[model samples]
Target: MKNEIIIFSGIEPGKKGAGNLVYFFLDRLKINYVEFKLHFNKTPDGFLIRQLKNFVPRNLSKSLYYSFYRFFFKSSENIINRKVILFHPQSIGLELSINLIRNNFVYIYVFDNFLFCRKSYNYIDRNKSCLLCLKDKDAYLKYKCDFFPVKHNPHKYDDFLLTISNNLSRVHFLTQNRNQSNLLYQKFGPIPNLTQIGMMVDMEDVVFNGKKTVKKYDFLYHNTLIEAKGIFYFLSIAKLLRNYSFIVPFSLKEVRNLIPDFEDFENVDFLSIKWNTGLKEILINCQVVINPSLWSAPVEGALLKSIKFNGCVAVVTTEYSFQSEIPSNVVIKLPDNLVEASKILNDVIDSEKIRINYKNEAKKWFDLYSKDIDISFDKFIQEEFN
Candidate 1:
């Protein structure tokens, strides 16, 4: 008999990355499930009710609006039989929803600690030095990180926790920074039945043709052009490497305008490529890929993609601990300072051996990781639910 699983995430169905992975895994397993796009508003007529509440008398209108909202917005009691429900990014509101649908089916929560920390929002606003969420009562709430421990209270919501890394499981996997695994272990007691599953990528359509030197540009930087992503820092490095060709993909024109004394260096070109088309083609052509994220570790998929294309990675050591063994060709643990990062990247370009080694290493690693994902999914279902 096929087991039915319902996986729910806070994000919309097809934005990118984790959400995309979730969809891919479910499809691969051929699991019978429904993907529901969660609505954040507490009421259907919330917008109209709030507008009317502002003009009408406070006491009577507020009571009437809330009563109407609750009657219409409250979740129904229909529960799926012999099914397992998995919730990503623990939230008090989500836990409450699960309780309303509770039956004999198992409920599991996937933990990604970075989602709970303030540093997660480092890329959001460059001008703002720190993340501060005035809405939440917790001191660490400022970053707009969504995880809430209150949702995990046993008496209220008893659900199994599946962490992303073994090191994280030891510390209850509170942050995305793998380096802080020990720190978390010190804070929280040891976790039980924890598993380490690296980030998943859909490779069915990914065409790999050994390594080819297609020098469309000397260097490329993909991802949002925001502060924490180190876009400004990358621009400065491009200025220093005056002779080398640099490509900045999908950066807003306004971001370039913000930099003072930023000249249009002849070799540097800013290309407005949509992520779906231009970005992929650029990755395929570039000789090197540079990622200088100030916050959050390197996503496994991003790092793996760079390696697959036989490109070197220049990223902050603090963010991505370089925990998993990497191809020596793929450079990790670069200086947090942009000048140092630029120097290292330049030196690697000069070293032919380094480039060759990385290409070979990346292919080997991808093969090892690319083993049938369906097998893992089947194992997870049997072990966890059965």
Candidate 2:
């Protein structure tokens, strides 16, 4: 029987990391597949929906908006013998689409433990996981925890998630690592089926380049500078280290919107993420990359990329267990305490010994992880039959 694999998601081109990883691997798999992108902004009535977003009641607005999408853009019924791989269908009226994935052939991949969180950051009580949403349905609203899926309709979001979680138990899953697995188990009492698949990280092209030698920025933390992402922590470190420079990849416009206070800081520069080669060049020259998130990261692409570049990675204790999957010495585990993490980072600045050792250990770690990455897809496919 010919199999049809559909990778469904809600993506904004290059924005979501999970979407990017899923698309890359599905293409590499070279199978009979369909890429059904769920773009909310471009939907037929999207403009009208936005025009009326504020006027309409929150839950009613979400229901009308997503119900329109569910009615218009539907799951293709062509594949009788096929499998579905869902990244994040939360945006596509998940409340209405639950039945679309009710079959026995579906496989769901949970990239983020957002299910555990009152918010997508997977934290409620600053820098820590809060399970209040599990008990109090109003906890999401109480904390003002805005999320990508069901942002306007969180009550419905809770209902859909409970249903999705129940459905998720019916299929085989692709778990990232031991650390994430434990976290998911903690959040979700117990699961019936799981296959631990390592993240698909390829960085040989960006890692090794003899031509790129100019280190324009002293440090780089190129991600959406949100509070949950420890943006304030990075800024706090920059405030102390006045001598060194730091780059946060955000547009001049974004800087004004996201961190207006930090715009004047001489040590920090927020550059717009460009579509051109400039982005890669800027990434190559950074002395170190840091992911100072206080919350647990299931699939840490940033830290992995830093290791791939043979550069240094500074992180907090939340990443300790995830770091073990790499077995690399390049990772400089920072303390969760804001003051202490900065102090350790201060010592790391301009330390030639630290840089050299990190690059060396990264090479050893890359050799091991790359080999496993090569076969992860085959393992994922095999899980279906076995």
State every prediction's TM-score relative to the real structure: 0.64, 0.79
lDDT of 1: 0.49
Best by TM-score: 2
Instruction: Please tell me which predicted candidate would have the highest lDDT against the true structure.
Output: 2
**Number of clashing residue pairs, candidate 2:** 0
Query: Model 1: residues >4 Å from true position, as ranges?
Result: 1-3, 31-75, 78-115, 119-187, 206-215, 254-265, 319-329, 372-377
| Steric overlap count per candidate | 3, 0
RMSD of each: 9.5, 5.4
Relative to the true structure, candidate 1 reaches a TM of 0.64
